[model samples]
Target: MKTQTTVRRSKYAPSVVTKNDLLELLNADFTRECRAIYAHAVYAERTRSRDEGAAARIARYGQETVLSALVLCELIYDYGGTVINNLDELNAVLNADRVADPGWAPETARRLHERAGQLRSAGEPGLAKRIRRIISAKKGAVPLAALVSGQQAVAGR
Candidate 1:
């Protein structure tokens, strides 16, 4: 029997990702989802009076992000891990005390893409495929314009 704890890098991890790499990825993703929900809520609250449409959209997005977090949490548990619950860890940057930094979501997507590539290179193609699905669920990089103008940013919207 083998037991594994969090190990830094893990780039040399086996193709299966049974160690801490995939666990770490899933946890990081959960943290991102938490940040998304927080930012969306803040934006929605601040924009409600001036942009009810955007507020509503933000609320919906927040809900969707919650689902994403739950999914990631489930994965973490199934993979023999605990969901990180550090408040200070779920951090995001906003401008004007209201607007979400335009780069946040796309940066997240970019990191996820990079992680997927790493997983593929490490011989964990199946896990890489899962990450791709999460990226596809975003349609593409979320444009700040969509949040302000109530544009359809999510795919099939």
Candidate 2:
């Protein structure tokens, strides 16, 4: 049997960054310093929790998971730079398994995706690309798979 592929366009066209752009950003001294600091803090927090086993406790109870999800939602909403107009759509998009397990409701996901697309169109290329990748990875529709594959191919891996 033969299969055909179809392309689906993002509702908004946001600028995207090349690997070179990311490399350049990473190579900057200021950026390196900031990254180092962030890494250190993350490590320290994790290390300190090791003694009390708070990390294990949190993980066992799902507190960390819940907090992480909340943080993700806030970060996406803030960075997407647009308010999701349709709660239902947003839930659907977020709930799609490819994007997340026990995902956001379909409506929530759709709204989030729409907002993320708007951010992509607003010159926040990196954030937009991240959102697009998240949605694509969730494996919802054929168009998304095509786009993800196309991206991987372009990356020459």
Candidate 3:
């Protein structure tokens, strides 16, 4: 079985993404999902049984985040995009404060929704729907936040 891969094949990636810019958006979404994985893991750890039920839920969310990443990898592979293996890139930006803070969850979910919409417009309705469902189900894992008035939230913030 041929298991190894490298950037040499990146040039083979399809250019169908040009018009819809789906790949770029998906890449950004993947990054956010990765950050969520890290953040949620921290949440699970620090939650410390403040509420036994809530703690279990938080830990489950971390698991869901892992699942999302797996699905995302499949999507990338299907679309002829390169899979990102260096998670350290994600870890570099996620600081102790951000990991412990649940505030980023709502924003993360929003970005995923936006990407799913783009995926649909780009003729990827099934993938888009899958993304939506995964995101919706994981909302509890994400911390709820009140939207800021008179300001649009920036992605990956």
RMSD of each predicted structure: 9.3, 17.1, 13.0
Candidate 1 C-alpha lDDT tens digits along 103-129: 666777777777667667766677677
Worst 10 residues of 2 by lDDT: 25-34
C-alpha TM-score for every candidate? 0.65, 0.27, 0.63
State which candidate has the highest TM-score. Answer: 1
TM-score ranking, best first: 1, 3, 2
lDDT of 3 by residue, 48-150 (tens): 5444454466567668877888888888778778766555754634563464444576666776777676677678888888888778776644441221110
Better of 1 and 2 by TM-score: 1
Number of colliding residue pairs in each model: 0, 23, 0
* Candidate 1 runs further than 4 Å off: 1-18, 89-99, 118-126, 140-146, 149-157
> Pairs clashing in candidate 1?
none
- Residue 44's lDDT within candidate 1 is 79
Query: How much is 65 displaced in model 1, in angstroms?
Result: 1.6
